[model samples]
Target chain A: MTEKTAITPATHTVPPAKFSHGVRKGDILQVAGQVGFLPAVEGQAPTVAGPTLREQTLQTLANVASVLQEGGASWDDVMMIRVYLTDTDHFAEMNEIYNAYFEEQGLKEAPAARTTVYVGLPKGLLVEIDALAVLG
Target chain B: MTEKTAITPATHTVPPAKFSHGVRKGDILQVAGQVGFLPAVEGQAPTVAGPTLREQTLQTLANVASVLQEGGASWDDVMMIRVYLTDTDHFAEMNEIYNAYFEEQGLKEAPAARTTVYVGLPKGLLVEIDALAVLG
Candidate 1:
């Protein structure tokens, strides 16, 4: 049997949170929930950056992608997505940008199964997304 | 190319929420994020039913198992899990029940890789969990 490896990426300047960002099993990568937090650049708080929902979402996805790559997975390997939004009114905008990511990659096969929830968010962030990717 | 079969269960009254509760891709079953609402019970509100996080988690996992059975998967097939807790303070309680479930089943293999998160949950629910299972 071939052994599988796992990757844990501790990024940015934030001290280690209780949980690792993600863990891989076999060929699958299950990413932890990622909220909209900017990479710390200096003395300012990372969460204070990204004043808009769209911008926060973009940053969140980028963070997810970084973790995915660390685990030998890519956006193309993502098979499922779970999105949490603080407001349903932003769904249209979120979907537009969300679709663009997959569309731009020209992923013509079965689209990644997804679920979007409109609910309260910790830190009062507007959006967050977690991903599952299979490298098979 | 080999043909793959799919299973979609509509037994519960949750309306599948945003999409199908679970999807079988290749040998892996991906279950969507499940909240603490019981579909069979009348007038079940997502937020208020579970007086505690442990109660909510059990109900949520039950809901997930129902869909897994429909998809020809079992609790033993679960390979990884991402659990969302509205408050990280509940982690100890969540793990107490989580360990009980797997221990009851005599799960000895590399324990299902798990990641826990503190986030805003739907309605007033305390916890939610999404899972990935490998059947092969």
Candidate 2:
């Protein structure tokens, strides 16, 4: 009986919140909620931050992908994702970029089962994403 | 090759106002952010909803447990849990009740690799809980 190993990122800003970045229990990798967190540029306040919401979101997912790579996995290993958007109006825009990422990754089968919702986010950020990847 | 599964509670309220009560994939159960949700008492708002934060927290965990049971599992199968509190100051009070629950459940080891954080929650709710459980 192997237990899931919890993975906490060394980059202080990767999580950008109280939660840990990812936890690997057995064959499962659970990525915590991520928002527009750019580790190198996270210090800049959103007000002063130049990256658009879409840009930041991509950057954050990139960071998550970086972690997955470190753990010997890829985006195709991801089986489920939960996206929280501060504005549902941006769902199309977010999906546009989201689909592009998957397409670029060559995930032709069922994209991960997803749940998207509009919510009030802290730090007034535009979006937050969390995921579950199976490495079994 | 296996596809992950999502779990919905049969007895609990559907589509919680703030977040999903819980989600399950395969043998792993990933509960969404849950705060002071009282299915027993109807129409109770997050503010002043629970008689106490401890009570509310317990109710929220109970809800999570119910969903696990509905999926043919139990609390003993829980692998990880992340708890968010509006105020970290309540750690002591919450811990008392939290410890009591685990003890009652005969949890010999720790109560799942756990993380607790203080954060701003919706509806002024004091606490919210999310969890992951794996059936061996």
Candidate 3:
């Protein structure tokens, strides 16, 4: 049996609850849903980056990447991704930012399978994302 | 390299878009988020099992189980699950139903690691769930 290990990067603030930033079992790592909130500094309330969906989407992906790296993986190792948006109207813009991120990472030809759905996010958050990666 | 294969069971209605119901990469099967809407009949608009959160949660789990089974898995094979609810007020009720389902399936000792978040589902939908299963 593969034991599950929690992965939390020192660079990231501790999550508010009991959940880890990511959990690794065998060769797989399942990351918790991440919003665009900036890393917590000791005594301040967490807040998302910019007010626009594009800005939040960027920060969210960056956060996901941080978690992936902490788990000893990379974007290339990600096999699937799920994007949650508060408004369907922002889907196209979110994808534009999303696609550019992968393209810049040199993974445009083999980007991971993705699913996007409109869902209400926490207050002030326009986007949230989580991912599954397979380590080679 | 492991190849990715899409799984779509005949018993389920085709999704509105291009994505598959589930995607298998090696031994890991990642199922797309499934809403509580009942399986489509020949000539009917899709509807959730009932208007209540409990009813919708049950049907959503069933739908997830069907997709998992079609991909050569069962609830026992599930390693992680994420639940999305439209209302945070329904958390306790959702967990009661969720826990009971696992108990009934004889998975009380080692239920899949789970994360629940508040998110709005499509209109008229109360819950949506997705899972990742590992096959031996």
Q: How much lDDT does each candidate structure score?
A: 0.71, 0.65, 0.80
- Runs off by more than 4 Å, candidate 3: A1-78, A88-125, A128-130, B42-45
Q: For candidate 2, give the lDDT of residue A117.
A: 71
Write one digit per residue (lDDT tens) for candidate 3, span A1-136: 7899999876667798989999998888999999897876777777778899888988888999999998988876776788888886776677678767776777623345455667666788998899988875
**Top-down DockQ ranking:** 3, 2, 1
The CA root-mean-square deviation of candidate 2, after full C-alpha superposition on the true structure, stands at 7.3
Task: Give TM per candidate.
Answer: 0.58, 0.60, 0.63
Task: Estimate, for each residue in B1-136, the C-alpha lDDT of model 1 and write its tens digit.
Answer: 2222334455454433223467666777777777776665546633334678777888887777876788788887888787878776898989999888778867767767888877665456787787878887
C-alpha DockQ of every model = 0.13, 0.14, 0.14
- Candidate 3 has which clashing residue pairs, if any? A120-B120
The digit string of per-residue lDDT tens for model 1 on A1-136 reads 6555545555543534766677787776888888777776667566634768778878888788878989887776676788889875787788777767656657544445465666677765888788887776
Tens-digit lDDT string for candidate 3 (B86-136): 788999999899888888877646778898877655678878888888889
Question: What class would a CAPRI assessor give candidate 3's docking?
Answer: incorrect
Decreasing TM-score order of the candidates: 3, 2, 1
Clashing pairs in 2: A4-A25, A4-A26, A5-A24, B5-B25, B5-B26, B7-B24
Q: Output the lDDT of residue B64, model 2.
A: 72
